[model samples]
Target: MAATVRAAEAGENFPVALRILPARLRSELHATYRYARYVDDLGDELTGDRVAALEAVAAEVRRLYAREPVTDPVVAGMGPLVRRAGVPADCLLRLVEANLRDQDHPRYQSFAELLDYCRLSANPVGEVVLTIFGAATPDRVELSDRICTALQLLEHWQDIGEDYAEGRVYLPKEDLDRFGVTEEDLGAARAGDALRRLVAFETTRAVAWLGAGAPLVSTLHGWARLAVSGYVAGGWAAAGRVRRADHDVLGGQVKPTRSDIAAAWAEGLLRRAG
Candidate 1:
């Protein structure tokens, strides 16, 4: 139902699990992602009275939670899937709140503060996925948190140029100071040594966090295992891109190639098979 909305939000980059999940589960996941993506776009892309648009979206979210007849297409499509999966209402709301936070606070002062933002932005999606898989144990959720947070950090690094152009900066001011990078460095088209060093440092942190979360892969079976491993591999592959580019993100966002994704996917499957 929300397939069109999902495409509008995320151009066919559905999760790796979608390839293996049953049609029903796949549809549910699509709806879920579509809802999140809709909220993000409302906050990030809507021009002129964005706050009003987001407020309207929030009202739609509230309607979904109330099981009322939803007028918004995104909420109507997602409400049933969310209810069926028993995903916590707060989890989805947190995603909306994250985008809301972005409307007000685009630049973070500290890494801790940025992580707090990720709690709202990234962690809820992981929790929702875990719920869908029936693997929302506290231990698993903890592991999922690590993976989701790492993925979010990697995404921030990848979108440095685009984010800066939008007047958003995900890099913490403290880290920038420590690495001797300035806002001007990030704004430039070319990255200098200081900016490269800062990017390297941030990517290393993401790698460490992803590595810590990788063990969650071994704890699952079948498609879930493959899916989690693919996520981990994605983080690593993205980090590899940054490293390969020598962390010069000012030119453009570094992304994993098809070979990188294929190799990482295979490595994930092999790891599970062993």
Candidate 2:
């Protein structure tokens, strides 16, 4: 819970899942935290036998519900909540599985390939939450896809520099070639017009993807609605920030102020009332 809050408050993962969860969901939140932090950490750390580290994470999660097995931080952190909430062990495992894939492969050739990564890296998260809420359904899952995938794309666009440093270029090579963008362009100290145009196009795609899922706002009611709405709105707001910055994402991506979020929330209320 603390780590998830830190990630959210740092404005990295806006619409922090913890804020709107009911009292009963603290455990599930912790389970989510345990899963997300490790999945993300594996990618960031990228150290010392990636396969072994991934296997270790997978083992820890697979053993989570076993009554007699020792509980590590992965289990210890969320053990209580997963027990009470019965968060699917498979969902957590899928996250680790994705990280394993990330360790073995980092470059993505197309938006479709990138989205396939998100199926594990991001989508399982929404699936896990829906399971916790007892709301898993094909229909709702479709909306969740928009939210999750947009978040993933938003993150990739924001982390261009970091990804390049790791020898991983997520921008499809085909797109780069089509735009006449080169490694030199990305390797430059700052983004030039071509790069800016690329980011603008990509950023526009992410914003529209998020908007396509806005109906999820009304799909959930009260806290749940507010939570889903905030996520959708936050994605839109972040897109606007990037757009407002003239799409110089290398300089800095747009981040939402608390007031920006509050304004979004208030507008959501009005829309709901209407």
Candidate 3:
């Protein structure tokens, strides 16, 4: 709980693990936070011993898949949700494997590769949320994939500068080359026209993908729809921010304000009500 609180306070991962959850969900949400934190920590903190840390994460994932109760706080907390939702433990285990994959391979060769990574890194979270809402179905799952993938791409596009600063790149090499961008372009302090165009192109695709999933907001009810709509709206709002910034992602991360989120919330609710 303490670690979860600190992470939220520090504003890592959108304060998602602890803030604004129903009172009934706080405990389990914190547990999920702990699990994600550990996986991330293993990848980032143990960089010097990355291979070993990845092996441990993989082993734990295997154990979880084998139907062993994970004694870790988050894993322990997940047991109830898992049983209640009939969620495949494999999803949780795959999360671990995905984090390890990040340590081994961060750069993507193509848009398809990036989307594949998003499937591993981001899609399962939406699936779990759908299960939590008792709305998991094949159709909703497909919509969830589109929304999650869009969010993942928006995050990547907005963080191009930050990622490059950290000696990593999320921009697909193929797209970068198509836009006449190079590794040297990323090494710049601010984005040049080439990089800007690449971001704009990727942002367009993300917006389109998000739109494809927007109808799911109508397909959901109660707070479940609110949650999904909020996530989808965030992607749209983020894209708007990026566009307003003229795709100057190198300036800094242009995040939507709480007012922006509230507007999205209202828009979603009104649409759902109709």
Question: RMSD of model 3, in Å?
Answer: 2.7
The positional error of residue 125 in candidate 3, measured at the CA in angstroms, is 0.5
Task: List clashing residue pairs in candidate 1.
Answer: none
lDDT of 3 by residue, 65-140 (tens): 5678565554555667666667666567666777778776868899898888888877877777777778889899
TM-scores for all candidates: the values are: 0.92, 0.88, 0.87
Better of 1 and 2 by lDDT: 1
Model 2 Cα lDDT, one tens digit per residue, 128-197: 6666666667788788878888987887887787778877777877778777788667766678899989
Q: How many backbone clashes does candidate 1 have?
A: 0
What's the alpha carbon RMSD for model 2? 2.5
- Shift of residue 200 alpha carbon in model 3, Å: 0.8
Candidate 1 lDDT tens digits, 212-267: 88788878877676566767777777788888899998776477865676677677
Model 1 scores a TM of 0.92
Please estimate how well model 1 matches the true structure, expressed as its whole-model Cα lDDT.
0.79
Candidate 2 positional error at 251, Å: 1.2
Candidate 2's C-alpha runs over 4 A off are 1-9, 18-21, 65-70
Better of 1 and 3 by lDDT: 1
- TM-score, candidate 3, is 0.87
